[model samples]
Target: MIQHIRISRQLIFVNKILFVFSLFGLIGAPHTHNIRAKRYFFPLFIAIDGSFTEVKVNEWKGAASNNRNQEEDGSAFIVEILKNLGADLVDSVEYGDDELTQILLSEIKDVWRRIVNNPKSLVNSGETPESLGIYMAKILFIAKDRHCESPDETFINGKCFPISTRERSEHCPENMGLYDDEKNEGFCECLELTKEKAKSELRPIYSNETGVCYRQNTQGPCENGEWFVLKNTYPRCEPVPDGCPTDGRHVFWNPDNSTAKQCWEIWTRGPCDKGQLLHLEQDSTEEPQVYCSYRLAESFFTYSALSFPPCPPGTLSNYVGQCIGCSRGCYGAFIG
Candidate 1:
């Protein structure tokens, strides 16, 4: 019995040793594989301020400490080398802090050496003492943070503006006025006839109501309103629709003819005076349906000035003041 007990204890000790070795093997395999893979996996480009720039990691050898001139200090030498390699360091002082600058200055020599040897490894491993790869990443993050986060926004004159504003400014000439956002349809427009301009040159007349330019005696692009006519010696959209009353009323026009028009009160008994109120359907494919029904709290109502409700979550208002749904698959939000 004593011999058997001793043999059992020896077997237990051997099992524990085997378990430890197995655990270590499982953990070290991936680490060994990563080290081997990193040798030839350096990034060819770096992203900065929403743009990609080509980077040559092999050229980092020239920035090593041994290559510095005797007259130049470490920081100065590294800065000069980076400038020679096409680094945009002019805005570095504006973006970088003192702590980061001091940290880079103190350990730049070691960091550059690590980068020169294996840039991919230093970047992937998140090395201490802040490798050059890490510094560049931080710089890139700072630069991106300073600009706008929305895709619909554009950086202009050190400020963020809506993309529609930029598009209008760029596409529209000085003689032509900006097209109405709701009816722009990705096209520039001529100036409105109401605005006074030099009469030496004949230009196309723009209509604010129809959002179209009309030539002399031409029909223009009117689909619901009156045809184009020469009014006051200029081709213009005639018989403009009258404005609706401010007390929850909207313009009701005949879709078939458009000449017969009137202002109708919303959410009230009108043509159907039997105790039903007018209701307009939302997201209708056919003509806007205005039917008589009992008013409900869930029904949508609009004022004469056309006040829009707040946009739902994950959606934003566009240049035309219409709520647009955000894309689900993309990383950022954009207005269409």
Candidate 2:
């Protein structure tokens, strides 16, 4: 009888404990719960191209440059952007060995992991997902963010937006909305430049959906009363205008690098009227000319935070910003 009573008491106690645990889990256990640390693994390519083999990197930037701290600032800026855009920005930064290369690699890895990798991998499979191996098969060096200034400082070419006005954590004014950051002045200035450039010409090159044609140069007078000319192409317009068949590429692109003979396509045909984007392809590789792939036509450099696509040689496209050729082709992932 005593044994039976003891067993009953013990079972009751066990049931009570289990019930309490269930309640805690439902109500207040989160306050006491410990979160498991997320492990991030850089791809072999990023690991090898970057100066580190680990997920973390250190910048011995105690006195390297004024913008040394800005690297972290940039990372933090990115973190906020990613989070606001609903990303899994749960990892804290880790440093391997304090160096510029390490900082660049680490910061870039931090950003890329969030942007490129799916959150399901980090959540369900942890760091060693099979899909990761596909991308990490080998480390390839891409100069996506490797453009560094001389041995003195950091130079971020395409970052000219105004700084943040808010004091939120990791939030910078630069990433804040355009209307909020007092960037309207700069945007207004850009508009003025465009207006002046467009007003100088009586008839500029007009790119139809299919190909680039010109505003028709009337032989004598237009049947329509409007001042606009009918559309013309390479042979038809070449003799009429001083440089009629204007290097079709040069019509849209005003290349600043001089070496860039590519066209940057601008957006047009709307209230938006994005002019054109400049695309260039300068293959400096030793590979035979006959074996280049089609992906080579998508290299792009940022003239601003907005992206510009690049094109390979013999490919034609409109110019958007200052045009230039790169030593190699850029890899672009179109979000099809």
Candidate 3:
């Protein structure tokens, strides 16, 4: 009878413990939905040739560039790249209010594992996890942040906008606009260099949605309205106006070397425009004359792509092929 009473007491204690655990489960357990939401992977659009293609996050893990610290650094860099391409990254993800967890390497890997288990989380299911972590991070970032208005339109702030149109023959300048091809909707954006300009500092110039800056010849005005032509048509405008386009496969040269000094010498003679990017091609990999050509035209460089090394540490090869130094308080950076 005494043993029976002890067993009953023990049972009661176990029941109490179980009751406490059940209560904790009800009140303190992590939300499965929140975990799923955190695991949700987003699609990233990559412009291939002239069209944009959807890339999954797992696939991007293989392609992302590793930092000096052996961590995925390309994610943050790609974010800046997207901003330069003209979309509000923070606002697009709805994370302006919440601190973004995916930006960190731990979360990046964690989300990747979840995505591997459920391929349906990606827009493209067949993609394999390659060395595309940076690319994947960027894709996931945009996917998580992009705010869609309807099935057809994307929302920015309170307004709805269209998706990006077809890729143009030329890369758009900072003074120009770009559309969001990620949504496959129409969302053209232009740089507002004059956004903060005071009324006194501004001029009444005719601006249009195209964002093309036209230069009038002004040679006594023909039947046409002042014989204006695209600034790009001139030989002087041959160099990329908005800096070099970032393809995933760019190799940057060290500007501090002797080879770079030779390139600087060429830059000094030509008086290249500030921020112009020149591409030099070579047949033999070793000690070949690095012919300088404009980044815009994809065609193989002929005589025009001259043999020059590279600009010095403090300078950038500009549009006119001149070595332009960085302003005071600023450091020269090579974006390869």
Once fitted onto the true fold, the runs of candidate 2 whose alpha carbons sit more than 4 angstroms away are 1-97, 100-104, 110-237, 241-336
Give candidate 1's total backbone clashes.
0
lDDT for each candidate structure: 0.34, 0.25, 0.29
Write candidate 3's Cα lDDT for 194-214 as tens digits: 211211111111123233322
Q: lDDT tens digits, residues 231-298, model 2?
A: 22221222333332322222222334455333222222211124422223222111101111132233
Better of 1 and 2 by lDDT: 1
Indicate which candidate wins on lDDT.
Answer: 1
Q: In lDDT terms, how accurate is model 3? A: 0.29
Sort by lDDT, best first.
Answer: 1, 3, 2
**lDDT tens digits, residue span 205-323, model 1:** 44445444433223355444444443443344444346543221343533245346555555556565576666654321122245656655333323221223332222234532343
Q: Pick the winner on lDDT between candidates 1 and 3.
A: 1
